[model samples]
Target chain A: MTIHYPKGMHHTSQVTNMMRTGKTTKKALTFSRRGMGLEEEINVANDFYLANRLAVIHKKPTPITIVNVDYPARSAAKITEAYFKQASTTDYNGVYQGHYIDFDAKETKNKTSFPLKNFHQHQIDHLANVLSQGGLGFVIIKFTSLNENYVYPASHLIYEWQLHKGKQSISYETIVTHSYRIPESLTPSLDYLVALDEWLAHINK
Target chain B: MTIHYPKGMHHTSQVTNMMRTGKTTKKALTFSRRGMGLEEEINVANDFYLANRLAVIHKKPTPITIVNVDYPARSAAKITEAYFKQASTTDYNGVYQGHYIDFDAKETKNKTSFPLKNFHQHQIDHLANVLSQGGLGFVIIKFTSLNENYVYPASHLIYEWQLHKGKQSISYETIVTHSYRIPESLTPSLDYLVALDEWLAHINK
Candidate 1:
C-alpha cells in the first residue's frame, strides 16, 4: 500500500472536495443516534483499528494562522484571532506497513453518478505526483442514498477529471469499471482498506 | 500505551496538553526555525512515510458546524459561516501493523520543562479512553532549542499530568525519568516511533 504527498506539503484540490470531506457532507443528515458523516465513520473505523492495536491514523487540525493569542493565566493561552489556511492535499493520509496511503472521501445523494466536480485539479496532480514517487493514491466514494461505496484510484479520477472535463460526471457503471467497491459492515463500517487489498493484488503488485 | 478523550466531543484539554508536552528538561536553544511546529514537521514526515511506503497516517479534517454555505456554482459550496466543533480526540492518529497507533505532536521553547497548560483535561481523558479501548497512545515532544525529540507514551504522560495539578508542573527530571528520549537524525528528523518500538517491546512481552 502506498499514499502520496507531493513536494512535501498539502495539495490543494476542488472546492466541494474541501467542504464535504469524509463524513462532512452537508445535505443535512437527520441526526441519527448513530448517524455520522463519511469522515466520522472513517474516524470510528480508524479507532476500531487502533483499539484493536491495528493502525495509527488521525484527522489533521484546521491549519489556523493564529495571529492573536492571549496568555491571561500562567497556564492558559486563548487563541483570539485566526485564519484558515488552504490545504495542499486530500482529506486523509498516513503510513501502514511501509506503504503510504493517501485519500479523499466524498458522499453524494444523487445515486446516479459521482460528479467529477467533487475533485480538484491539484488533487489529481498530487495523486499523479504520489504515483510517480511510488505511492498509493485513491478516493473513497459513497452514494449515501444507496448506502454503497467505491474506492477509485486517483489516477483514474485524474484522467477523467482532466481529459474528460466536459463529461460532467462519471456514472456508477464507470465507477464499477474503474474502481474497487467497498463493503459496509460493523465496527469498520466502510472497509475501504479492504479495497486497497484488491488494489494491492491488482495494481500495487 | 494509552491516551484518554473526554466526553461530549470537547477537545480543549487534549489540545492544551499537546502544545506544552515535554517530559524532560534540556539546555535552552539559541535559535528557532518557523518549521519547528509539530504539525508542519509531521506533515513532512508523513510525506516521507507516504513516498517511502513506510506508513499511512493522516490528520483528520477540522470538525466544523456549518451554519451557512453558499452555492457559488453547480458544484462548489463555500462555507460562509461555520464554527469549529470540538474534536473528540487528538488531531493525529493512524494504523500501523495490524496494531492501532495513535498520538499527538507537541513542541515547547522552554529549556528545562514543558508546561502542562499545553494539554487539556479533556484530551487526557480521551487518551485514557483510547487506551481503555486497547489502543497504542503517545505524544511526540520537540524541544526546539535542544533540537531534540522524544516520544512519551500517553500512559506515562497522563500519569504525570494527573499527579501534577498539585505540583504546578511536572519536573524536568521526572519527565526525563519517565519518557523516551528521541535523538534527531536524517530520514525522519524526530523519529519518535523508535520510542514506540521500545514501548511495543515491553507490551508484546
Candidate 2:
C-alpha cells in the first residue's frame, strides 16, 4: 500500500481529516453486515460535494432529550439516560445550485406496494410548509426487497398520505407513475438530487 | 373529562388535537419528560412556519460513516457500530424568506470566553464558502454557564479563529462586538433567525 503523505507534513486539515474518518480494510469476512445508514451515506455524498466545493449539505445530530446527565468531568457532560423524540420535519435539507432542497427517507420491505403508514402527519405537514414557502420538498423511498430506490416529491407523498383512509398503500405502478429512479453510484448513491434537476428544469421554466 | 367534538372532526389533524397525545397519563408523563433536542426544537420552529405557511426551514440528520450493522429482520436494519464521518459543511442550513441560512450551534461552559477549540477548520471553510455564494451564514453560541446565548456571524468566527493560533479563545468582549444576543420567549427560542434578519438588513443594503 502506498502512503499518501510524508511523516513530517502534518497540518490542521490533516488532523481534522484524521478526526473525520478512519481507514477500514475490506476483510473478506464481512457482508452479513449491511452498509451505512441512509443518513450516513447521504453525509458521505455531501462530503464529496464539500471536497469539490460543489454544494453544501449536512445532517443534524440525532436529537436525544438528555433527561439525566453525569458530569464526570469539567468538559464532558455524559448523557446517562435519554429517549428518542419524533422529528417534526424532514431529515435532509440544504442548498444546491442556487435552490433550496428538503427531503426525508423511508425504507420498506414490500416488493409491490409501499405503505403510506411509514410516513407521519408531521412530515406531511412539514412538506406542505416548505412547498407553501416556495422551497422544493421530496422523499427518498427505498424498496430494499428489490434494491430499488426512487425520489417522490413531498407534494406527491402528502397527496397519497391524505388518501390513507381510502387507500392504505400506493402501488409500485403508482410510484412509477410519479417518482424518479435514482441511479446507484459511489458518491450520492441514492442520487435523488437528479430528480431535483428535473423538478428545477420543469418549474424554473 | 368529557369528550367533545369541536364541530365535525374525524381527520388525523383533529385526532392529534383531541387526545392528550394519545397515551395513558403515566405513559404521557414519560413521553412529556422527554425534552426535544436542539435540532428538534429548531424543527418545531420550522414546523410552526410550515403549519402557518411561513418561511421554509429544516434540520438535516447527522451524517455517519457506518463500519458495521446487523440486519436482524427484513423490515428493520440496526446499525451496531458507526463513527461520525467528517461533515464537509455546517450542521444547519436551509432557506428562509427567499434567502439561504446556514449555521452551527456550539455550547461552552465558560462565562467569559468561548474557546476556539469548539470549532474546526472545516466548519470555518463551509461558512466561508456559503458567504462567498452570497448566502447568510452564522454561528449560534450558547453560554451554558451564564444561561445566555448569542448568534455570532461566521465571518467573525473565522476572523477570531485565524487569531486563535495567537490567542486560544475568543473573548466575550470580542464576541459581543460582533455577535447578536438572542433573548428567550420567542416561539422558536433560538430565534437566531432574527439575527439573520438584522444581518440581511445590514448586508443587503
What lDDT score belongs to each candidate, Candidate 1 first?
0.62, 0.63
lDDT of 2 by residue, A126-152 (tens): 777676655678888878777667878
TM-score of each: 0.51, 0.61
- Name the 10 consecutive residues with the lowest summed lDDT in model 1 chain B: B24-33
Question: Where does the lowest 10-residue lDDT sum fall in candidate 2 chain A?
Answer: A24-33
True contacts kept of each: 0.07, 0.26
Top candidate by lDDT: 2
| Cα TM-score of candidate 1 | 0.51
Global CA lDDT computed for model 1: 0.62
Q: What DockQ do you compute for every candidate structure?
A: 0.07, 0.17
What is the DockQ score, from 0 to 1, of model 2?
0.17
